[model samples]
Target: MRLTIERGALLKALGHVQNVVERRNTIPILSNVLIEAHDGSVTFAATDLDIEIIDGAEADVERAGAITVPAHLLYEIVRKLPDGAQVRLDLSSDDPRVTVTAGRGRFNLPVLAAGDFPAMSSGTFDTRFSLERSALARLIDRTRFAISTEETRYYLNGVYLHSATGDSGLALRAVATDGHRLALADHPQPEGTTPVSGVIIPRKTVQELRRLLEDAGEEVEIAVSEAKIQFSFGRTTLTSKLIDGTFPDYTRVIPKGNSRVMTVRNDEFSRAVDRVATMAAERSRSIKLTVGDSKVVLAVNSPETGAATEEVEADYKSETIEIGFNAKYLLDISSQIGTGEARFEFADAASPTLVRDGNDPNALFVLMPLRV
Candidate 1:
């Protein structure tokens, strides 16, 4: 394989695919990226058995062939090259080395045969849909923070994506929960698409999909099946296996009878939580919230450390209520409220609290109170 590609173009393409290759791999080919030079373009593909990314960039191809080389090494070489410099790559089957030349610098990287790379099988997709990039971005951003990091409850380790009847008729919903808290967001279902089956998109793939959609154009194409999911946009494609566990029924967790409503400035509440949390113990990090008529107090106490209290103006008119929660969870859900104001509904000190942006039907969060 021989090709001449702009340093910026090559670096950008490598940036998309190389991260999928693990630094330490038991299989030799899994650590390398398959580079193919074809008619007027070059493609880079890398996979870690579960997830695969393929990126194509325009290049001047001198010879049509393919080679697999160290993904990180090639990325570093192109990244360090002077801006606007042209990079040339040459590799032949006889010599198991790839020659990379930019300006006056040269480097030879060991290569593996492209035929050794494992192919990812993306089975037939039962649901296909396309939506605005911003819509999906909002859904991911609103719920991804709530994904559980625990491996034992593998079902909670990813964002649950499915179709639901939301405030806006049929909607595409994403929900994630870590037992302690939950986040749910929805977008209007796109036209000309079949309803999507409930699937758990693993955290890693959710992260990669977020990165891929960073500077994406107007729309993104998605294909989903029981076992796999694929995202295609521009000149790149990402295929990932869906987590094979069933997500718990999240609807039952959301409280519908929490009538006591409290509204507060989003930034003010977040800042108060952060300040009071400093005095909390590293283990619990529990903060207590006291809601009184038109006022809210946030306080935290740790035996090893001191105590902190902050008073924030709120619009609470119900009976006095006291609730304890992890400061991190409060801040996370509050930060997702794009509106300046956030509304919280409480059933009692022990029942889960419901939170949402004032009058925004697109997203909601629930936090299970802690005993202080």
Candidate 2:
């Protein structure tokens, strides 16, 4: 195997694939990236069984061949090289050692036979759709924080993504909840359906895809199958196995008939919660919301940690009511509100309250109250 690839290009390809390699592996080949030099391009493929990523870049191909080498070490070598240096790699012998050379620095790293590398099954997706990278990023960032870490409910470990018929017809919706809090984010358009059922996008895929979507504004081609899903952008394609479980009916848990409404500036409300909650005990740091005719007060009190309260000028016209909620949960939900203002609709301290960003009547978020 022989190829000369630019130092920067090789490093960028390795950067995306290296993360899929496990730090500790029972199968040594699993720690290595399969490097294939064919035609006029080179490709790097790495996998952890559950997820696999393939990245291809243009390179000067001399002798077409393939080999497996330590992913992290190769990444480090190319990353440290001077800019514009050509990275020359060659493997000419049966018992191969990859020779890497760049200017004054050169090294030979032991290689594994490419035959031992694991292969990921290409999923047969029944339904496939395309979406803007920005749209997917927004959907993930808004709801991922609520994905449950509980092992017992294996289904909740990933975000539930599906097409729902909302007030404005079909919409792409994503939801996550760890019991204490829930996040629901959706986009009004760019939604379709197929025979294959909804799939739970694992947490790791969510994070990796987010990193990839950062520099992309183009539409991402997504293909989904019964057992796996694929996301393709530019020269990279990520394939991941779907978690096997059924997500609970989240909509049924959302409360209705919450008529008491309060409106406040998003930034001001978040700051007030942070300030008051600082003095509350860690075990039960619940913030009590007191609503009146035209004002709202946030109070947090812990006999051991002392008490703090801050008031925000709000637009409210409901019976004076007090409701308690986990301060941290409130802060998380508030942070994702994209608008300058947030609306909270409350029935009482015992009912779940709906929160929405600004006056977007299409999207609604519900949070179950806590006992302070």
Candidate 3:
């Protein structure tokens, strides 16, 4: 196999696919990337059994063939090469190694048979849809923070994506929770999308997909089946397996009868919580909020550290209420509120509190109170 590709183009393709390859692999071929050079283009593919990524770039092909090489090693070599230099990869039929040449630098890397690289087979998709990049990004950004990392309750380790009936009509929703907090976001369902059963996209897949979307075009094509999901972005494609466990009914945890409401500027509230949290205990990181009239006071007390208090103006007319919460959880939810006002509904200090973004009615958050 022989091909010449621009340094920048080759680096971009390698950077996208190499991340899916794990640093340590029990199987030899799993640690390498499969490179296929044909016609006028070259494709790079890498996988770790559960998730696979493929990226392609145009190249000047002298002899068309396929080979596999160390993914990270090849990526670093191309990344450090001169910016505009042309890179040539050559592998003769009798040679067992591939030679990389750029300018005066030459390096030989061992090769593995391309046929040994496992390809993730995507079975027939039951649902297919298209979503604008911005819309899909919004759904992910607002809810991913709450995805649980606990392995025992594997169902909560990913974002639950499905179709639901919203205030306006049919909506595509993303929900994630870690028991202490939950985040839910919605977007209008695309016109021709078929209804699909809810799917739990694993955490790693969600993260890799988010990174790919950063450079994606205006629209992304999505295909979903019972056991797998695929996202196609022009020359790149990502296929991942769906988690098998069933996610709990999240609606039961979202409080519905909270009567007390307090509205405060998100930025101001976030800053106040951050300041008082410095004195909180390392394990709990608990902060208490005293709300009444048109103001709220945040306080943190730790036996080993110290105590701190800060007051912020708010819009509230209900009876006085005191609630305790984890300072980090509060900040995570506040950041998602953007620069708008944060509305909090309380039903005393023992029940869960509902939070919403004033500027975006499609997003919601629920936080469980701690015993202060």
Candidate 4:
């Protein structure tokens, strides 16, 4: 098999697919990328048995054939080649190696039989739909910070993606939590989407999908079955196995009747929290908020470390309330509010606090208070 591909194009395709190959492998074939040449294009594929990515790019195919090569090695060689140089790849038995040649450089790499690679099942999807890339990105960015990293509660490791009838109407919602804080966001459900059982997208899949959607303006085609989910965009396709656990009922975690309300500038609140947290204990990271009389003061005190206090102007008209919260949690929730303003609704000092963007009702956050 022989082919010539522009270095830039080859590097881009490899970058998209090679990340799935783990640096350490128990199986030899799993460490290599399956490269197939046919028609006028070359396809690169890599997988970790759980998730797979395939990317195709246009190339000059002299002899159509396939081979497997170390994904990371090929990527590095192509990436280091001169900018617009054309990369020539030849698989010949005389040398018993795959030859990669560019401007003034040439390297020989060992190859594996493509037949040894495991095949990813193209399972029948019970539901398929199309969504705007920007919309999907919004849903993920808003809630991913709250996804639990704890492995024991496998159910909480991914975002809960499903269809729901929100106050605004039918919507596609994403929710994630780690028992300390919860994030919930909704987008308009795409047309002709049939309701299916909720699927918990593992955290790793969310991150990769997010990267794929970056700077993408085209609509993304999605297919979901009971066991797997697939995303197709441009010349790339990603398939991932769904977490085989049930997501807990998240609606119960969101407070329904938190009456006390406080409105503050998002940036101001974040800055105040950051300053007060400087003196907070490294382990606890707790900061106290004193709310009253159209103003709120943030304070943190540690026995061995010292204390910090900062005041910020706010529009708090409800009964004075004091609450304790983890500084990092406050910053995470505040950073998500796109609008310059943020609203906090509280039931009391001991209950969960609801945080929302003053301009966007479709997204909100619920954070449990810390004992201070």
Q: What stretches of model 4 exceed 4 Å from their correct place?
A: none
Candidate number that wins on lDDT, 1 or 2? 1
The TM-scores of all predictions, comma-separated, are: 0.98, 0.94, 0.98, 0.98
Cα shift from native, residue 259, model 4 (Å): 0.7
On the 0 to 100 scale, the lDDT of residue 15 in model 2 is: 91
Model 4 lDDT at residue 102? 97
How does model 4 fare in lDDT? Answer: 0.91
| Clashes (N, CA, C under 3 Å) per candidate | 0, 1, 0, 0
**Model 2 spans > 4 angstroms off:** 189-196, 359-362
Which sequence of candidate numbers ranks them by lDDT, best first? 3, 1, 4, 2
Off by over 4 Å in 3: none
lDDT of each: 0.92, 0.85, 0.95, 0.91
* RMSD to native, candidate 2: 1.9
Give candidate 2's error at residue 292 in angstroms: 2.3
| The 10-residue segment with the lowest total lDDT in model 2 | 188-197
Residues 118-196, candidate 3: write the lDDT tens digits. Answer: 9998889999999998898999999999999999999999999999987778999999999999999989989988975
Local accuracy of candidate 4 as per-residue lDDT tens digits, 1-372? 999999999998999889889999989899999999998999999999989999899999999989999999999999888899999999986767899999879899999999898868977999999888888899999999999999999999999999998878889899999999999999977877886458999898899889878735589888999999998998989899999998988888789899889999999899889888999999989999999989999999899799889999999888888899999999999899854799999998889999999888999999999989
- Screening candidate 1 with a backbone cut-off below 3 angstroms (N, C-alpha, C), the clashing residue pairs are none
